[model samples]
Target chain A: MGFDGDDTLWHNESIFSMTQERFRTILGGIDAAEVDRRLLEAERRNLGLFGYGIKGFVLSMIETAIEVTGGEVDARDIQTLIDCGKSMLAHPVELLDGVAETVEYLANSHRLVLITKGDLFDQESKIARSGLADLFDRIEIVSEKDPETYRRVLARHDIEPERFLMVGNSVRSDILPVLEIGGQAVHVPYHITWAHEHVEPPAEGYRRIEGMAELTGVIAAL
Target chain B: MGFDGDDTLWHNESIFSMTQERFRTILGGIDAAEVDRRLLEAERRNLGLFGYGIKGFVLSMIETAIEVTGGEVDARDIQTLIDCGKSMLAHPVELLDGVAETVEYLANSHRLVLITKGDLFDQESKIARSGLADLFDRIEIVSEKDPETYRRVLARHDIEPERFLMVGNSVRSDILPVLEIGGQAVHVPYHITWAHEHVEPPAEGYRRIEGMAELTGVIAAL
Candidate 1:
């Protein structure tokens, strides 16, 4: 069994959303939703160049701030974004409901691995703070969650795709890619989702649970 | 045989040095070397939080800028730093002397892996642009090139430590770690080095070559 970090095991996207709100407040005079749209656009444009993480997000926010403010942004405004980023980096890791109980229960019967994508240090820090380190047999903080990445990871561990199961929150990131590679997957919906991570659900061959509390039942059914 | 990407295969640290010079030029009133010292300090402090990459370096620059300027840094100054980051990320991949000829020479009769550490997208882009992608059988972009990372990479490929060989520029990153794990290593010195990657040479047990042109001969002797 593989577990996704970020929004699956803990609260992640909501923190980003809250940070975006702070950005919108700091850089007023632009439509709030428009600010989000532009920031997301900047983020997408920068993703290939910067990769994903708070540092990239902060850089994208700075880029968006300059774009929205017509290059007349204040130093303190940029400083505010930097501070926001640092604060988020320093934020406490709060585990989701039933995450500990579910992972603990599953670890007893299965070889559990945590396959999540993001900045290496950020993810490692969160995992260390999440206090679930002892439960996982391996931790793979990947750059992206795609079919190829999943295939390589499974191959590295000598696990067959047909026997592997992936659980996460994002359809684009965590679900479809695994299913595409002939691996089983379970999608547990989170309260908030990044627009970039949104995708139309696939037609078949995956499980969906409303929350992590239902995970054990899903596993038993599997 | 495994190769290190950044300084070993291509021109990398010089670009960072050029950027640091530009950073000094933009933020006047401080000694140039003093600027470098502070930037290095910020980088070391941020290493665990931000990880090693261009993104982390940019964040360190911003943090150092604010520190040096006493929170009086100009918005334009911050923008210039951001532009510096973008320019670095978009820089072309220029292979070092004899790198192509050496790797090409070695690839014919050996299993070649490129093991590099940094921002995933940036490293991938450099590798793709390096025009040497077809030569490598596997590309491992790790978060850090430590003993555990080397061990994992070797194990994932089912390569034993005695049979594995690593070649790179930094003693801290490439040589000692491989040697510690019973793997052969060749250290080819680069003209520039990052402060964080500098370390006192180990007592023994690794080959040191002057350039990539000599790599083929070293491998032949082995």
Candidate 2:
């Protein structure tokens, strides 16, 4: 079994938040909430325009700032946007529930791998900070995650897709790729899922669990 | 420019947080620091597998939990994961530094919009929670973000891409798409950025800033 990280096993992304009060204060007489709504729209627009990458998101914010300020924008506002963008690269990796336990339980019977992606250095640094290494039999990081990646991984391990069980929260990265390659996969929903990975009406041969805690049973069923 | 609401603007995400102190407790006998190191590696691997969405993040936690506990996992652990996951999803929206002040200041001249991608109900609720809805001249939500989407939006607004600016913390969503269309864009660094949006070689015509407060200068420079 393999697991995905970031928002899953850890509480990450604490840095990206914006206070509603701050947004309200900026828009002045305008409703702060309305500002949030507009910002959300802008993000959707940017995401549609760019896909799931970091650079475009930062630009969207700069664009939002200019638009919100009605083009009377000044250095102070730009600086605010700039500073946020610089460090936006770091994610505070906090752990999730049953993440430790479930992995351990599964480790008893399965060969586990930790697969993730990022700047490489950042990811490695986070793992070093996490204090829970040495559990997986293997760990791999790759730029692209899809059926091809899953197939290659399985082939490398000499493990049949049916003999391999993939557990994750996203249909995009975990379930879909693994399933696409004829591997069994399980899904555990996390909080605040991104829109892209959302599977409408679910997919075939896919199972859902509320969280990591339910993994043992799911694994048993598998 | 657009912004990423959940983590970029404010403090969000708490899925992996629950296990920190607990991990310290359980693995006290081991090199806690070392354990964290290995765990962090596993986490990086997980992110690549899961991407930026919430579901895979949660799964990473469970996998981490299982790895750390050495098969001593239990119900309390699982409960913790789910509870934390829900918290991450339902947690209050927070804003980054100077965002409120900057937004208000920018509102004096610019046309601001919120662009985000997420679940409909969740995104709408967050907009309400963020309290910045009225700050924007418009709000748009879409299922995808790509270069084509950016082109269409600019075309619909009858705004020349060169004259238009996209500001955001995400290189993938905000900066690149606008730049791809020959639009001007700015990069504002947020403290903590989501992993899925990471990009490289920043797009052309990208101007960088430290925070939204810098917008005043940036707008003037333009």
Candidate 3:
């Protein structure tokens, strides 16, 4: 069994949403919605260069601040942006409801692996803080969660793709990729998502549960 | 035998140095030397939050720009910073002199694994571009090159630490960690060094060679 770390297990995009809202207040002249759009644009542009993580997000925010402010952005506002990133890094990992119970239920009988993507330090820090580190048989912190990455992880552990199952919130990162590679997947939607992670609904042959609490039921059904 | 990817096998920190010079040019009115100092300081401060890689460096540059400019930084200067990151990412991977020949020579007789640390996407991309992928039995892209990380890799391969040999540029990252774990190491110094990677010279019991061309001789001596 494989689990996606960010939104699937805990609160992630909510932090980004909250930071973005704060950004609107710091750069007062711009329309709040416009600032959001521009920030997203900058993030998309930076994905290839910066990859993904809070650091990249912070850089995009700074870039957008400069563009939206027309080079007149306040130094304190820049400081505020830096602080936003710092606080997010310092933020405690808040597990989604029922995650612990579900994981505990399954780990008792099955091998559980935490496969996550993003900054390595941040992910490791969160894992350590979550106090659930002992639950996993192995922990894979990858650069991106894709079909190839899933295949590689499965192969590394000598587990056939048919026997592997992935559970996560993002269809793009978690479900579709695993499904494409001949693995079973369960999607448990989170309330908030980054635009980058939003994708078309999963195709047939995959399960979608309302929340982590429903995860054990799906696993039993499988 | 294990290889280090960034500076030891390919040009990495030189790109950082060149980018820093450009940053100095863009953020004029501050001492160029002072710009370098502040950039390094920002990078150290952000390492825990951002991790290592070009993305974090770019973020630190932006932060330093704001501080040094006293909130008056030009919008174009911000674009220039973004461009620096993009160009570095777009830059081709240049293998260090004699790396290909030496690796090919050693791989015929010994197991070679590429152990590198940084953003997963960036490291994987460089490995693909280096065209030396077929030479390694395994590739481990990790968060940090610590003693624990070395132990894990060695154990994963079923190779004892006493039989493992690590070769890289940084004394901080490559030599000491592997040495602490009872592995032999060869330090092939790169022309440029990042402050974060510098440490007290290898204490003792480590081989220091001038270039990759001298690597095989050290291996034979070991």
Against the true structure, whose DockQ is highest? Answer: 3
Best by lDDT: 1
- What TM-score does chain A reach in every model? 0.98, 0.76, 0.98
> What residue pairs clash in candidate 1, if any at all?
none
Predicted structure 3: lDDT: 0.88
Tens digits of per-residue lDDT for model 3, B116-203: 9887778888999999999999998887889998998999899999999999999988999998999988999998888778888856
Mind sharing the TM-score for model 3?
A: 0.95
Instruction: Kindly indicate the candidate among 1 and 3 with the higher DockQ.
Output: 3
lDDT rank order: 1, 3, 2
TM per candidate comes to: 0.91, 0.44, 0.95
| Residue A73, candidate 3: C-alpha displacement in angstroms | 2.7
lDDT of 3 by residue, A61-129 (tens): 988998888777776677688889989998999999999998988999999999999877788888988
How large is the interface RMSD of each prediction? Answer: 2.0, 20.6, 2.1
Q: Per-residue CA lDDT of candidate 2, range B113-188, in tens?
A: 6665443334555676777777765554433457886776666556677777776777788778777888777787
The residue-by-residue lDDT of candidate 1 on B56-99, one tens digit each, is 89888988988888877876678788889999999999999999
Off by over 4 Å in 3: none
- Per-model DockQ against the true two-chain complex: 0.54, 0.01, 0.56
